[model samples]
Target: MDPAPARLAVAVKAQARALGFDACGITDASPPGSAPHFANWLAAGHHGEMAYLARNAARRVDPRKVLPGLRSVVCLAVSYPGDHDNPPPPPALRGVVARYARFTDYHDVLAARLRDLTAFLNGLGGAEARSLWYVDTGPVLERDLAQRAGLGFIGKHTNLLGRTLGNWCLLAEILTTVALAPDAPERNRCGTCARCLDACPTRAFVAPFVLDARRCISYLTIEHKGPIPLELRPALGTRIFGCDDCLAACPWNRFARAGRLMREHTRADLAAPDLIELLRLDAAAFKVRFAGTPMARAKRRGLLRNVGVALGNLGDPAALPALRQVAQDPDPLIGEHVRWAIERIEAP
Candidate 1:
């Protein structure tokens, strides 16, 4: 409540920008405004296999549950727009990774920066300050907090889009007892634009501002552990990792500049990977290839499972040899998908 904490907020934002964060703002660590919507989403089973969302539902509403007596939340964004040189891969035997995952894991990148911000705040607030930070790994309603902090409004497609950064930014949060002054919330800017919703390959957006992860290509390719549903396989197309159709379709992205820090981390090879090569990756090879990247999170089997669907959708006979090899593999998850790919290629 003190004016000193208000001044500290200004300094924190300046320092965060210096550390390469694209945007920064503060909000009181009260319950998230989206708690009701989140509860509804979970009750409707829209979250699918992401059981952790249900498990951590309570903690998301109240930051104090994760960090006792938390009074301020410092939210930050770092843009990861795809490299200007790296356009979407041609729809062929090539598989596309989400632009964000085309680089080093954002979790690691954003967490390190948030830690530095925490140390700065702790030093300013003295021993009375307690701080904890998260980079998408926490049970926080990040979009709600980010919107409340004035960074951006949550777009109808369910992503936070800033006037400048569009939907191409990653978010991080720091919860602290330092009591920084909060920023005013941003007004909703998505008046009539529904391009993001209309662009979904799998019709994941059940309605404006609501997403069904059950049918989302990103969720299917990355989060869902078992085989992808047959109904969604054709929509999976050549996207092996995550999908960016909705985010890329946002008209606001016309204002988005290429990511400065993330540009250096983008791997050209990952921009449009050869599906045949990905199918050959055994567990050991997968780890070695995508060691520090977000792609590693899917593991070899999950990624290969996705690759089979993509190859099937491509219906490219060039992939038949690889799919046949994978069909004989010991992992039923991948083998089953490989068999499906073979059927699709062989089908009239």
Candidate 2:
């Protein structure tokens, strides 16, 4: 409520916009109302293999645990262009990557921008402005903070959505010692629209605003380490890296446009990649192709596993040769999925 800190907060938001952030707002580093629900979600095994979410549970509920003197949290959302950010369902065997992964790794891109923002905020707040920042990597509950900061409301699909920014955003945060006036939280405006829930190929949403990661295509393709569940394979379709059906299904995306930074980060090769080409990637080839992109997180075998599922769903038979070559892959996980694909494709 102090004038000096309020002025600094306004300056910080302006600097963030200047640095290409689509939205910015501030909230106190207090415990969020959703913390108990998050605990229940984790206790019910909804987080899947992302054990880190549970490991840092305390810090996530209380930002003070992450930064001992934390006072305010700066929440930011940067939207990527709709063209590559909202890729339509693939035709036949064409593989689809999530909108976020189609471009360079956002961690790298957003980190640099956040660093600059941090420096500017520190300068404005004087020596008392100690800060810490991260792009989706820390114990911070970013989406919850963003909602409290008024950047957007959490949609029924559990992704953040703004009137203008939609759900196509990469969230990042800065926890600072400076006491900035907080923005009122955005009210949930999703109403009864069930488009995101209906659009999910795997039906991962257990209920409104709740996601079961174990059944989520994005979690299976990108986070799960072992073979994907047999029943879920067919639903994966041709998404080899990550899934975006829910995010793309949101009507708010109609307002999304290609900003200069987003356009520069988009990679043409990642848009509608041929399944055959991706299935052919060896460990070496996979690294080279996805080096700077978000897809690299899947590693060679993880990606190959998803590709096998796509091939099976493709049922094109043309992918048989590719599947056969990896049938005996040294990695048992990849080999298992490849054999499943062969069986599915060979099924009468």
Candidate 3:
């Protein structure tokens, strides 16, 4: 390895950490070659109705397709540490948003940081060393790239798990023309660990390293556009936004250290939200409450739909009045879920 690229890589990584990135690494920007697997998963209907995942097959598999002259990928991870114990939902209430959605949207925070990093890299050179950034919004296999860059190993749960940051981190990438030295991929650290697989209440993980998105609470609540399947409703419990059982069960989290001031970015009202308060929100009110948070992605109807499912799972007669009110909502989908909850509440 020439001293120039090595020295530059070291400095860039240091600068990334100083800029609030939890971890950073560089790797050649080659196509992931995971297309066949992704295609098979799509073919198997594992992605459910997420047509967008199947739409950009070529661009997603090949970074070069998106940026023709890309040479290297700079993978970065930002930690979102939470100190609260995962709280049990109130007995009769509904609508429990995930903790990650409590704070400001990660897309905004990470994109700004990526822009600054891109500007710094550009200042290191000129147009000859250009870069493009992505923060979960782009067609990128961010976890694969991050793993190839040695930032972390993909745990059995399929979430990227950093040695010191665990799985409580967001991934972002920079496709650049600069030819930085690449880091070797990290070794798999999850040996004989089945905690995440066993912890999933819905059995979303069909096997190690494979997830059936349709059964995943995160996909069901947030990504799925229609009423959640009846059979899966009970399994959803009070998780109205996304599920974190897999990530929370990972042993690596025990070693996760607290980040600096950036910790404030992920910690807010999301620790354990009030179900009744969230269930009462109208579209306008939902927007105002979530504001810049990721919870806004679900929209009011989608959120209410999940909340109804949670109410059904609660089996508490006290939730009947709220469920009855939501059952009359104008949105047909929300009304259907609320009706389902009403039936459940009235059942023996």
Q: Using TM-score as the measure, which candidate wins?
A: 1
Determine which window of 10 residues in candidate 2 has minimal summed lDDT: 81-90
What ordering of candidates by TM-score runs from best to worst?
A: 1, 2, 3
Pairs of residues clashing in candidate 2: none
RMSD of 1: 1.2
- Those runs of model 1 whose alpha carbons end farther than 4 Å from true positions after fitting are 83-85
lDDT rank order: 1, 2, 3
Best by lDDT: 1
Per-prediction TM-score to the true structure, in the order listed: 0.97, 0.96, 0.94
TM-score of 2: 0.96
- Candidate 1 vs candidate 3, lDDT winner: 1
Alpha-carbon local distance difference test for all models: 0.88, 0.87, 0.82
Name the lDDT of candidate 1: 0.88
TM-score of 1: 0.97
RMSD of 2: 1.5
Off by over 4 Å in 2: 83-92
Which digits, one per residue and each the tens of the lDDT, describe model 3 over residues 1-348?
567667767877888988888899999978875568777777888888888878987789888888888878899988776434436455546456665665688888888889998887766656678888999878888888888999998898888999998877888988888778899998789999999999998998878988899999999999999989888899998888998888888889998875653566754476556666777899889999888888888899888888888878878888887777777889999899889988988998
